[model samples]
Target: MNTGGKFSDAELMEAIQKNEGKNDAIRFLYQEYFDSLSSLITYNSGSTEDAQDIFQEVIVSFVQIVQDGKFRGESSIKTFLYALARNTWLNELKRRGRMTQRNKLYEEGRDRFAVPPSEAFENREIRKQLLAAVGRLGESCRKILALFYYEGQSMKEILEQTSYENDQVVRNKKYKCLKQLADLINNDKIIAENLKQIDHEQGF
Candidate 1:
């Protein structure tokens, strides 16, 4: 079976299980599987951002399972990853109370690859609006928000990544940037409806 990278399936599994070159293995997984797994969400009732978040969650869970010796290798890694992504996305949809007809069909073992035209359009609009909102932010604010939220960097890490003098400065800047982003998002009804969860998640 093609493993989609320099490492074969067994090689990747061994690296993960033994904690040897595991970072490389994980990076390989990201490059090889992210597009396929993320499409599982984006083609469903999820945005690109949602797909990215779910993929990250799935990678963490997969690493843990491997370390715990729970991955029996009964299935190919690709199959296992797709299963994880599907289940994770389904649970997210349930949590958001967005189990639409397509989702119901997915649960019933129907084809879920078909993207509804309206959902595609709405996803495009949401991306456009979000980019516009981010563009309105000052360069420093934009960098701070991107590092904290999108890259999941801590204040200390942000300080190291940027020219900030200390953690306190990074934290203060991040808070202000998040507030500005929230304000921009709130001003647009469509963007607000799509991204309202960020405010709660970021402790705004």
Candidate 2:
């Protein structure tokens, strides 16, 4: 079994199809594609948590198709995975009854104009307030938020940085930290006013 640091697409497919080094193949998928695949969800009004869930589903479906001898090697694995991720996320949005809203947001993103000076100034102010709120969180919460949101570290990467026993532990801690941050932001009068004003301006 070739358990080297890298695998060509053909090597990965063969490993997966034969169930030889399948675990390593899956890990390779995560390491090579998680960030980009998850971006599809995140950019479409989905949370990082949502992205993670969708990517897991994509992996499961991809493996099954490969093992069933249904995945013809016409398209590259990267392209196939991307299509699977997109379709899965679209189905999820439809299931949640948010497909229409998602389309509206996508259109707005496509047709948006450049930011005006006033809106830009307001955005900067809002960011400052948000950063201040994050700063006020406890040390653990601050570290988790900074690593995940600011530094773009994966949960597994965060597990390496923190003392967490596993990725699930890191995820739970991160979720609690996010809830704490949200509560803190909601309870702050000034920040609440700023958020409201921004939402109003954005026609939300």
Candidate 3:
């Protein structure tokens, strides 16, 4: 079978398992799968950078299964990948406190895709406000926010990424950056009104 056009997970696996050089097969999978996966992450409280990091982790996990010869073909490749990506995103959301364990468990039980409501207009507005506030933040502040919240990097990892001498320094910096962002949002009357409108719509 041609290694293109969303190969059945079986077909992709067969090719991957048997092809002496299945780099093209792997590349085809990435091209077809990356956008959908990235969009799913972005829709569920992730930024573009968040999307990239999660997708990369998913790919790594997929490859590990293949290399270990542990894929049993019990599920289609796409289905398996979808499940893996969803679980990863849910775990990330939970870690961030954006979602609770109950919501994650509920989502795991459902065959259907759970999406944020179209009526969550206020959340969208808040995201816009938050992003604007983030933009106004200094470079160090922005980097800290992006690394911890957006990239899902741990504080230890962030410490390494930020060139901070220690975790305590990083923690203080993150608090300051978040405070700065909060202050900007609080001071902006228009954003506050928009947020209020959204809160009202959500009956919060």
Cα lDDT tens digits for candidate 2, 1-204: 668679999899899898889999999999999999999889987899999998997897788778877778777889888877776676577557777765656544331222123323344446557778989999988999889996789998999888989999989999999999998878877777777888898799
lDDT of each: 0.77, 0.79, 0.71
Choose 2 or 3, whichever is better by TM-score: 2
What TM-score does each of the candidates earn? Answer: 0.52, 0.51, 0.45
Tens-place lDDT per residue, model 1, 51-128, is 999898778768877777777887788877787777767767876777999899887862244322222323444766
Residue 58's lDDT within candidate 3 is: 68
For TM-score, candidate 1 versus 2, the one ahead is 1
Q: List the lowest-lDDT window of 10 residues for candidate 3.
A: 112-121
Residue 138, model 1, lDDT: 97
User: In model 3, how large is the Cα lDDT of residue 158?
Assistant: 89
> How do all the candidates rank in terms of TM-score, highest first?
1, 2, 3
Candidate 1 residue runs with Cα over 4 Å from true position: 1-5, 110-204
Which candidate do you rate higher for lDDT, 1 or 3? 1
For model 2, name the residue pairs that clash.
none
C-alpha RMSD between model 1 and the true structure: 10.0
In model 1, the worst 10-residue window by lDDT is 113-122
User: How displaced is residue 169 in candidate 1, in Å?
Assistant: 27
